[model samples]
Target: MAAALAVTGCTSQSSGPSKVSSSSGGPAPGDSRTPPHSAPPRSPSTSAATSGKTPGGGSASGAGRTPSSRPPGQGAGFPHCSPGTLSASLRQLEAAAGNRYAALVLTNTSDRPCRTQGWPGLQLTSEGGGRIPTETARDRAHEAQPITLKPDDRAWSRLHWTVVSSSGDAADGSCPTPGALRIIPPDERHSLGTGWDLGTVCGKGRIQATALSTGEGPAH
Candidate 1:
């Protein structure tokens, strides 16, 4: 019925016989010239998104996000140093009774109190690094101590830098070098990136680099 009405309309548009289309169905005149209605074409200038990139590598817009772990502006899964502030350096290490100890400088470059929890811990890995971990240590020798420092303030704490294994079968007379990590930095906080290093608390007696206080594990 719609086709018959369209044919009648065409007959009225002209005199005599109207031209017949060979096509099965013919679109109205000018229809082919018209663009189909659609969402506006994507803007040529529209910006594209990126998945991930290094911190200093790209603009803030293209700046790739980090892997999911800690939230932005909060601290959680940092390896050793916290974000924002400079991390302290692992400067010095020294000999101890059965095991060795390390001295670290908790320096706050920024003018703020750096809050940290637990003892600064070091990992003791053997030269061979065997399975079942025959000789190694992990985690800080933490105690009931919370660290707080005023702007540019430096405080000291000591840990059993147990360089040798329990059996006392050390690789060499010297203790294997250690890799250190800071206590988990708290959320909504920052630390002074400020280089901290391993230093021994040596005195007429013992590992005196960090202050002498009993918390956990045998004293060095």
Candidate 2:
């Protein structure tokens, strides 16, 4: 009886160890099968560079780049010539029918082309920087024409005034002599002029102006 009991006990102990070993080798309940691998987030600049884009939203074909300047008459959108971009001068062209005639010439000094249009705003000023009141006489027969001037090219307008009276005459009276002419380009508020000696007249419309043209005009 004692021998039979020992064999049973040995069988049970061997079976118990095998079962424990098998259970230990496997994953436990509620345990994950493998650890997950996470990646880092990418930055916006890095993403844009890889996609052939600039941080400023520019593309590979130069889109969003600074636009080059355009010439006049290519479109109405072309900018007009500001006084800063021009050099101006006046020359008496002739005297006709008891009136003095002169050409106000403007030369484009910029590298780009510019438009000269409409009538130039005109005024007379003293050498002391005081505004001289004068009347503007528009040439009714003259037309407002737009002219395009390329670099170093020129445009001109005509001005006519009555001969200065010496008597300070009461009927065609005399006024303060002007030291300069104030010229404002068409559609602009800025002015340009140099020393001028247009003797003053008492009446309105003493001086008349024509619109800008390709050359000096009696035919604007």
Candidate 3:
């Protein structure tokens, strides 16, 4: 009886250890079924369409726009004549006592009508391309008149100078002869180069001029 009890005890002990080892050594059947890997959620910037905007977060259409054409005759409101649109000519007129006079004529060459007013800025240049000093004077005789020129309309100004001094001595600067006149229209920046050969320009401020007019005739 003692031998049989020992054998039974040993068998129960051996079977207990076998069952525990089998259960702990390997994974369960349900655990072997792995959960699928899921990707991370995307940011708002990554999905531009969902945010109702372009990738740059602005409107895509009409990216670059330009201005439309300007209205007609808008530039004609203050149409002042430029030097390029007029022809300048000069001629000797008369001599009284010691003073000499000449006419500077400007003719419209453009198709449209333009206007000019005030005295012209004049400077005498030599044949070798040297600028001779001169001073301009306002003429109370001829008032400032806005001369409007059509396609072929013309205007004129009288330039006067004193070749002799008050004491009857020759004026300073050796009285150089002028080859060409550089004329600047009123309120204009550009100057017109016109041929001019009067006689001689003397000291500073000796030259004077009357404002342009439509009534002034060409110097004969």
Candidate 4:
């Protein structure tokens, strides 16, 4: 009878330890089962890698995408007008005093709309494409404003120059005639060429220009 009691006591002690260990609610060192509510925290890198996304909310694949080259205030729908997409023309105005005047017209030849602003670069060239002496001065009396142009639409800039020679010009008041005029749009390196039929600009090839405006310039 004592032997049986000893066996029972040993079994109860061993079983109690097993029950206490199981109720501890912790994973054993070599236990294959994960403890309840003890999931590993997700790391940012792991999450990003799994979702194929960057921390900036952009796709990982788009991280290397090129940015838009359009200038500020210019919408994606209408880019700034480039010289290659424009055609240049000239309108001779009535001569006044010793100064001659004309309007430089720029027409959008592209199918899409474009924007333009500020003064355009002007140059005079010979018939053989040789560069001629030219000087352009901007008239800031009128402020420059962005002008949007649709296909076939136009923008104009006023040009004024003296036909009479200044002290800085030749002694005979004679000036070289330009066969072609090169018009470069603002912020562009390319130019559009147009014929120059107006007579000589006598003030050392100097001409005054205004910022581009909407529609055609003054008629007279």
Angstrom error at residue 67, model 4: 28
Put down candidate 2 lDDT per residue, 1-220, tens digits, no spaces.
0011000101111222211111112122121122333443598876665665222232212211122222323324335677778777878775766577788887777776555565565666678756665544555455555455666777777878765554534464555677777676654545777677545544332567666667544432
Instruction: Tell me the tens digit of each residue's lDDT in model 1 across 2-120.
Output: 01211111111123322222112323422112133344446654323333533323221211112112223222112222334434444344554655554344444454333333233
Looking at candidate 4, what is the lDDT of residue 66? 19
Better of 1 and 2 by TM-score: 2
Model 4 pairs whose backbones collide: none
Give the whole-model CA lDDT for all candidates, comma-separated.
Answer: 0.29, 0.52, 0.54, 0.62
Indicate the worst ten consecutive residues by lDDT in candidate 4: 1-10
| Candidate 4: C-alpha lDDT | 0.62
Ten contiguous residues with the weakest lDDT in model 2 = 1-10
Q: Is candidate 1 or candidate 2 better by lDDT?
A: 2
Q: Rank the candidates by lDDT, best first.
A: 4, 3, 2, 1
Candidate 3 lDDT, tens digit per residue, 1-220? Answer: 0010000101111222211111112221121122443543587655653555222222222311121111322222325566778788887886888788888888777776555665666666677656665555556484565455555667777888877644333454356677877666665545676876777766443456676677446536
Clashing pairs counted in every model:
19, 0, 0, 0
Q: Which stretches of candidate 3 lie over 4 Å from their true place?
A: 1-78, 165-173, 215-219
lDDT string for model 4 (1-220, tens) is: 0010001101111112221111113222221122343333599876565565322222212111112222334432355577768888999998899888999988877776666666776777777767676666677668676556767778888988888878877787678888987776764545677999998878677778887777777886
Query: Candidates' TM-scores?
Result: 0.32, 0.58, 0.59, 0.65
Looking at model 4, residue 116 earns an lDDT score of 64
